[model samples]
Target: MAVAAAQELDELCYLSAQAMGSLTVSEHFHVIKLLGEGSYGKVMLAVHRKRGSPMALKFFPRESTTLASFLREYNLSLSYCTHPSLTRALGIFFSTPDYYVFAQQAGLYGDLYSVIVSEEGMEEERIQRVMAQLSGAVTHLHSLGFVHRDIKPENIFLCDSSCRWVKLGDFGLARAVGSTVRAVWYESPFCTPEVGPAKEAEKEWERRQEEGTEEEMEDTWITVEPGIDSWALGMLTYCLLTGCFPWEESTHDDRRYRKYEEWFEIERAHDKTDCYAIMEERYRENPPPSQFHGIGSLAMALFKELLNPEPKQRGSPEEILSYLGGPWLLGSEREQRRRAQEAQKEAQKVSETGGLKDELLREGKGER
Candidate 1:
């Protein structure tokens, strides 16, 4: 939770060509240092000289036909930027045919992945802060009709003096309702395999007919829902608490059908002595967070609700906000009285104005 010295921070800065060369954005910004790289492109710590604040500039190479998608993602991120736990997408600029630029407020402390790996474990209070922040951010995103799709530790960052602020980043895989694109590895457990060409569909149908029985067929396929995010979140919470993954390498040699079976056996056999054991049991049969030691009870409760295997059983963002004590839903319990007053005020304002603005200023409209 302590701030690293300037020299120490400087040592952590990585340099690469992606961070060195000038990015082709509509407007110019000083590229300071490379923050990190990903499958799509590199993110750099940049400074808008005129604005006088550090920003993260993500550059996407134009060869992959992902320009339009990346632009849409960036624009979507901007709409949810006001939440304390969410990163703010300032603006996006595309200057050339081969590059796309995404600008965001820079976090002084790095990502949760590096932080957890470096510190080994975070304090309970810090962990609770992070969960509360993430819960708020996710709730806000859901309210705006978006799902992060990818919710790994690497995509969460910390800012401010005590590294208390948590921001969800990397919107490239985020999806709105009706979006067909899916994020690999972060795929929902319920996701069905993508149907390919006509021949492929025919083959799949034949395979299904061969399998027979609804139960047997369901076992052979997967479906995805918001619950998948919950599962990933549970994995993350376990990593934060135990400093390891629940499904560590098993001794079995089965690489295909039998691998998961072998791993599940191992998971079942592990003695409930350490944090890992608790995690394993929770993965198998979720227990309330209050049962866990050294972790915030509220956070664990939220985790249980989020990671419920049954998508229908999983908690909604509003429910999560309540569990985290979010301010949006707090106040007096006289619901209908407050609602009536608010409705009257809205009616008065509408009568005064004739109607709502015909053209609402949609935020985050441009591409990065």
Candidate 2:
């Protein structure tokens, strides 16, 4: 996507912010610029009028989100955003007649999706640091009994372009339920079999529509598990390693995923079946099957754990820590990148002990 120039972006951001009712908002904040906007609403860069501190103001339109749903999301943001690797929401939430608004520490570098697109892919060592932070954040959220249902590239924000500071954001789809029944309209790449079959789930969802259900449900009831986030983490790691996706979606309807699923099924029965070999023989002329080429053996091993078709067999997000000690890039790329990153860090080391959680807390209490 083409990024607008600084002047044009500022002008465009001001124009977008002008469309919303600004009386209450302007009283609290001076809109600095528009960060990003989507179907949900706009996220604006603003500064507190009284404190003069920067914040990212997220606005959810009433037409798109209900009061209950919006409040649920806001509450979850307040409850769990405290994790350093989780985007920290300011202790502020209020509603306008047309919007539900909240504040967060400004993610100056934008989201992970933009980074993946711009940088092509990341180095193995950086991926390690990123996954380390994310795994910790996922574990933190799950430990509190909440699942970040939507853990995708777009929702993972970057505080630094190099991904040294990344956080998981967007809790609109998060649910704390022991089990949930949602209406699935489309196949999602991050979901696995135990999340339930997409075709069957869609039928149930459609039945709800046929019955004139007022609120659209998105999935069929299934017990919540860490596999949900683990599967997504796999997808995130895949994108970080390879700029492209292994499949369009995880459903059988997707040809690429079907090929992968078939291989995985056989892989279960024959533990000796090498995925890399299958890629070489089957798609020899087709850029190799499953995009498994060029990745390290250890990474392929990790992928099997994260992308296991069966959710019951899927690895937890915390399992990523086990692989951190090993190489994830093929050949000498891992050592090369690792040493370069170390040298880069040696110049100016950033302390990891006091992170955003403490900083945000102090800021909230007016102690910073």
Candidate 3:
């Protein structure tokens, strides 16, 4: 079994590199510290020896990276670097067995996931601004004929402690809009309702294998559509407001799945309640900062459009921006002042907290 497992591991795309502590790349940047690591690769905080500019250098292990995939990401980064809402990739360089992506350091408040989870939750105006940026970024990507298959809080980076600015990062899962590769390997709660592991199909495949009738897995061929990002944005909005995912898991077999089904359920029973109504009530009870004073109604209206079960009817990025107008979309002097105030508040909060077991907050500062 050990031998078989080792063989299976060897077949994976990632090639193991030597331990990376205190490593430097391209003879210019000196590694200061390790940021994070995952199945694909790890990120490091580095400084350019000559310019003294700090950067977050992402190292993708060559063993796991294909030439095509590498080029795809590199080109996409270059193409989207000009956008204010997308992280700027300075350049790409190859160092022995690994490829390095040098990008502008993102997030002073860390990723949205950490901020939302730590702060208990966010106010409505803040959420509207954040969502506007995110949805607008997605719209830009779609206009360029690419789909950001993975749109979640973790991929959304906050530029400062105030949460005024956000940039989308990590393009590894991105694909052309009409590409045949339509499946997500890992299930994310932020994914569209229809997007998830094809458990039933996988079980059938398992049965076929047991019966010695080999069949190709049809799971990867799930239809890809443009509304995927919009659906995910809706889920992200939900998390921002509630500090929790709408569903516990992205599978249909679970009871939590019924919560989503019940929302769009056509036949309403006596005991059933409209999900939108319940959400609106909850928002009123525990609301976020709102520019419009009574943003709950406006928010519910947008959520109704964004969270629509039908992909065709789901709100587009343009529609979202239209719904959240003035400072949220086009930006105004008032928006600038509000952000400055928020930033000041954030700094005060950090000082008050004084690093009391807040590793994530500390890390965010360190990363910046």
Candidate 4:
């Protein structure tokens, strides 16, 4: 009974979003429930009073922000994006005396973070499908010469529990390829540092990091790099498979990240078929500071490409497209495991038959 009601609610939300097209500010849409609220604004589940369609409406208070800030995200979601994996605005933007209201697609299953917490860890097959779409979404954005500066799980929406339909959200921070990105937030002693040009302000910050001191540094920024999205993609993939981030931060001072960096050097240079086996042996002796104990071989390979320490060496999101048909594809891990078990059985059977034949020949010779 409850499931049915939830399904009906989801359908209404989808229909409401569709019916909300060409809507005007004067028209009323009643708020059903508050989806979430942050400093930027509050998102509410709303329905058109006349058409009875659903949408998650974001309300930005007029006093808190300017028109430019609202329009930046609203215009990008509505006009620039046409891909299915990327979320879209519902073409509704208006302002009351106190607030600027924007409507967007309502996710039935909420954001990817919610699902990750509930499921603990997603299966590799499911991760493959969801990551494929996200990778495409990132590729599409890159093709437009824009980069999504933030690509965390919270910004990713799951249209369904199986994650067959997912969308990337929160493009407000996206910028042009060569734009200078000042820190998203001010850097403090407690905050992580950035790596800019060798002569840039961040060089001194790097020195501070190397010296194991957290003394305050001057303002710093870096030019947009190619692998920013790729690095986040690798982190997201690792999170989905393990239900935790590989490391809390990428700073060299971070112990967990340092361990991963050490292993990554070995994993990157050695291309032998027995490379994974070698890693397994070393892992047993001294495990890295990550929860990625059971990751499959091909998945690990993709992670290496995406998370290369040198940003320029990291592969693009589109590189994941080819992996869809390879071992990184859905069910590939289980399929490989099954094949290995089958081969072991076949070899055992052959050995047993050889022993039986030899025993029979010996008995016959003894009788003669």
In order, candidate lDDTs are 0.55, 0.73, 0.63, 0.72
In model 1, how many backbone clashes occur?
5
Candidate 2 per-residue lDDT, tens place, 1-368, comes to 01122233234334434443434887889998998888779999999999989999999997888766655666567655678998877867777878889888788898878867532577777888889999999988877777787888888888887889898988877765354545353566776656446566677778888899876655455666667788999988988887777887787678888887776665465443455445334334433244666666567667777888877788888888877866665665456568988987865454543565678888889953
* lDDT of residue 5 for candidate 1: 22
Count clashing pairs, candidate 4: 2
Tens digits of lDDT, candidate 1, 63-174: 8636456656566666555787788778545435676676887776788888675324555446656776777777776656566767878788878545578788887766
Error of 1 at 189 (Å): 10
Clashes of each: 5, 10, 11, 2
Error of model 3, residue 64, in angstroms: 1.1
**Candidate 4 C-alpha lDDT tens digits along 12-82:** 44444444333444468887888777778788888978878898888888898776667667767776567
| lDDT score, candidate 1 | 0.55
TM-score of each: 0.58, 0.73, 0.68, 0.73
- Model 3 Cα lDDT, one tens digit per residue, 160-244: 8666899888877776665566555455566566654455567778999999997787864655556777777777776776676
Task: Kindly report which residue pairs in candidate 1 clash with one another.
Answer: 190-223, 190-224, 191-222, 191-223, 191-224
Q: After superposition, how far is residue 88 of candidate 2 from its true place, in Å?
A: 2.1
